[model samples]
Target: MDKKSPSDTAEFNISAYDQAEFNDLLFENMPDYAFVKNDSFKIVKANSAFLSMYPTNIRDKVIGYTTVEDYQPKEAELFLARDKEAFEQGYSETVETITFPDHRIRTLLTRKKRFEAIDGRTYILGIATDVTEREELIEKLRKSNDDLDQFAYMASHDLKAPLTAIAKLVSWIDEDHRSELPVGAIENFELIKSRINRMTQLLNDMLTYSRVNQTPHEKEEFSFKDLVLEQFDMICIDKEFNLSCCELIVSLQKDAIAIVLRNLLANAIKHHHLDHGNIDVTIEEKKGFYLIKVTDDGPGIDPQYSSKIFEMFQTLKPRDQQEGSGIGLAICKKIANHYAGDITLIDQPNGTSFLVTWPSVPTQQPPFKRIK
Candidate 1:
């Protein structure tokens, strides 16, 4: 037996497709509304499911003869135009709602491909997948988000009233009872004062978190370098730390971007392990993604609890140890998610680094922008 040459093998492989038992496989597992149309956009072939969807009269008349306009609703002209454009552009997949003769509507996401038959006939092969269930699920998720936003608004607003009263009472007790207070009584007062302070801080942070999604953004193009520099200056002046690596890089959205960087820097400095710790900030551009990393030479996080750091109200250390509201990282996570970005903590043998990856420019406006 002689082995086939490269050229001969190529020809034989092409012919092998014709003899392959695929025709039975094709019709056996055919889609519900599988169809083909000629260059004129006339129906050339439709599967059994397509025929079952229409009345006998319309089906018979429509077979081998019908334009998109003949069956599509008038309001759906734009959709048909898009399909036609896809057909002209050498093929496209379109999801359109078609009204059956029974007056029931069905969504058909038809993928059109330009192909030439053996007889040199140009046709558009369209395969449709039913997406009604997926669309319904999406709508349900949308409604769930709307409900969640409303609950957050209500919950935050309701919490502020009681918080304000507690703060006011704390101030009143400090002013009126300081002179008459016993030795240990003043310490109790201080405890109340500290509790009120923590409550106030927690509420304010919660309000900010809830409002991030609810608030509309003014995304004018601004330099990210300027934003980081301004934040670095403020942090340096306030706290004594070794943050020498001040690399200036340009980024968009002045205030929103500022919010993200502020929380990250705050966390770095607040959680420093050493008296004079190191904080390194790096900005890298990679394949349409902005990679911003904030590294601290502090005591690294435990491997077990690294995942829970960004969760709301989750803290590894007690309030006395870090004196944190525990909402900073949660807010950072929210801001990152607003721009379709993500935040992760990488635990090294030496220290911990918080890595944030955000798009240079968001692909779409944050979904909450449209809601009032």
Candidate 2:
């Protein structure tokens, strides 16, 4: 047999290089990170996507680096200890939360294999994926579902009493006195019917308000001034209370900021102190947010009763005193929390002002339009 020439050896090595490139292509698009190391645990290679995942360490920061200690010093120490154990025991071992600068952490499951190269060098390979965002989203979704479940249980239980009474009254009227009811009895029956209708409407509205956070919404750019003015126009129809006209500043929503405005405005309209005779709605734009003030010159909300107003079904005044289901402020709180914003009251005597703060979504950039 003829001995292989130098050129033949070069060609054979080139073919092997091509095959390695082909194999890398398969992993190039993979979401998980893949890497290789020598027997000494020095990183020899890392894929393109793997390097991109870690903003702290780009390709130049990592590849061809000696020892995981160069980047992940803590993980290097622990991994070396584990490697020794695995080498002796002859089994793969896992490691977690390999930390670096800026609170960045990655969990890695490393599988080890000892293999001798043609040049007599041994190597080990490892694979890992960033599960941080996935883990957090899962946790948030779980909590959301749990909250919805609680709301369902509460609404069903509370609504039952009014519904049962209304049903019984209807049955009694139909069975006992439908044909021979005395004069004016029909008017009394109509009044009862109206009361039941109102109660049913209130219960349904309360349930809807409680579940607003759980329901998904389409986020869009809307002016806070526009919403406030719209509410003002609607409330203007009620001549009993005068809503003052004030120059409103514009505010934008990048996320669910609309919900914040909706509930706050609704509360302002629903709870205005008619006795105070005037309501002042002010909007101030400052820093990177818009501050909303709904000031009622009416009988001031007692300082003692202010805090509990946001609690579900907690009302300072009886249902007769104020026509409210007691869920509006609770919904305001839920929406504020959902957007990572807050709503609170400012101190004032014989009048109350609710201050709503919302972080502005950057709207300086033009809306997305396809480039021609």
Candidate 3:
């Protein structure tokens, strides 16, 4: 007190300001709307974010006023009710659409908590995070998916009629005019028929790919071995190729899993160069997913094409050389994604091994440890 140095005085002032304005600094700088209301719901304090909702000249008018005085009556009523609930229950949180003083409607994730100040006064602290853009994006995505589904339905329906008529006409030409045509012409007609057949398969696969997960299906318990056997029975496999699965019970969408297994089995058999090859189907239960490994003793895929294999209409072999729609792997990937899972080609020494990581029951757990 006798002779306080200038630096000591400056330090004292800085410490005092910090102690008094620490909360104010945090509240004013916060990105979200933050405010404090007294027990009677009168706004006692509001941060810059909250004040920004009003005009600059009249921003000070927001303090000491209730939400009813600042916002639309209807919106204010909802806010007051939620505030009252928070006061009674100690806390409340909700995602609500609110109209600001500037008349802008915004979606907000609001949290209200009953708080007590150092003065022993009861208050409510409200913080709201604007989520309008996020919610709007989600809604747009939902609408886009709906539009795509409708387009796919109409396009498939419209295209199939013309495709069927053309197929019938080609068949009639082959049956009724084969003898009258020259040998070269006959081969040409056969080629035309083969092309038509390929077109038909492509259309069918396209339809299947588009319709996947369009409707929700209930999950049910089924034996893994039984599902593999059932799907294998539907497909015509070479006698020398063996398809086997271990015994395990799983709960899943039976029809969806069946479709996945059907595609994988079909792919393995169709791509195999050798007549006698082994197709082994095995399942391993991991931390949070079921690893379905489909190993084949066939000409393995090039590692370069592994990522591209799952893309729609992507194929490693030429369409002319291999009779395939090139949509099987894509459909498998889609189905896996629908269940929050994934399908990938695991590199192997002698042949291709596909790993389907099907999410375990209650598919909300962390991702499974990826196999290297």
Candidate 4:
């Protein structure tokens, strides 16, 4: 055999035959369904992935046939219309539920684009990605979350009755045996009462947190000043603290917003490290959201714990030192997220400043069923 020079090896070229083989390999190996259709919606070419939708024995019959011949008339008509739209509009995409020849239903994200082949023939190249399993998993996760919330709500509600009865019984025992009990016994009874009170608070906070965004409330127009004043009446801070708010009117879910404001204001008052301090609320209309800043002249929160404070059952100070169930900020965060907003602690030199970003309009409507 004649020896081939190095130059001859370097000049080796891939023929059209090799290129076609490579393209076929890629199309067949792809994980998504791939097909080519003529202007009339006839399946002219289909990859193995697309053929897999039909039985192996009848796969060969799929080519050169329109969807109307292979699928139900209603389903075929919808697909034909989508294909025609793609050719007319240049492209079309949709997420649709499809029933295959195997009788299995699937959710598919499909895209069809009009393109001209090398032979100058216009064709619709279609690709479909199966997303049925993903959607099913998402639905399962949502149901699991709903079940967990129901369990938490019911558990907390049921606990309150027993807790109240125990508290009453303890009070009765203390009153009935006041002189007969020893000093240590009296102190123990007081501790028991304190623990009972804490338990009650915990259950109440749990119920509130679980129910934060579960139910929908009607949106109402109200002024910032009036809303804060209304919450203040309910909170009733004992210390002489200044409450200042800007005059801004907003239309929002009134009851939900009230929960957020009430929790934040109560936190400021409860955690104040002074006999009397100042609490100021200012609102500014931003481009897409309203900035509500609540500034207090009390000791500020540690920056290291800023992110942690928003988590459920997280508290900077010991529960004994600070009487809290630690669900206040978590509830606030949930309510904010429900409206596609957020709450963050703004870094300030003196005292803590919490910046609340509330969207001008809710990004997503609450999932609760509307009352007729």
TM-score result, candidate 1:
0.80
Worst 10 residues of 4 by lDDT: 363-372
Report the error of model 3 at residue 148, Å: 3.3
How well does candidate 2 match the true structure in TM-score terms? 0.53
Q: Compose the digit string of candidate 4's lDDT tens values, residues 83-141.
A: 99889987887777888987788988788889988899899989888999987898899
For 25-104, candidate 2 gives per-residue lDDT tens digits of 86676676776667666667777655764565444767676536444676667777766654455445454566743346
Any runs in candidate 4 off by more than 4 Å, and if so which?
Answer: 1-30, 36-41, 68-94, 103-105, 111-126, 362-372
Give the Cα RMSD of candidate 1.
6.1
TM-score of 4: 0.79
Clash count of each predicted structure: 2, 1, 0, 0
Q: Give the Cα lDDT of each candidate.
A: 0.73, 0.65, 0.85, 0.86
TM-scores for the candidates: 0.80, 0.53, 0.85, 0.79
Residues 132-209 of candidate 3 have per-residue lDDT tens digits of 998899999999987887787678778889989988987898789878888998888788878878878887888888
lDDT of 1: 0.73
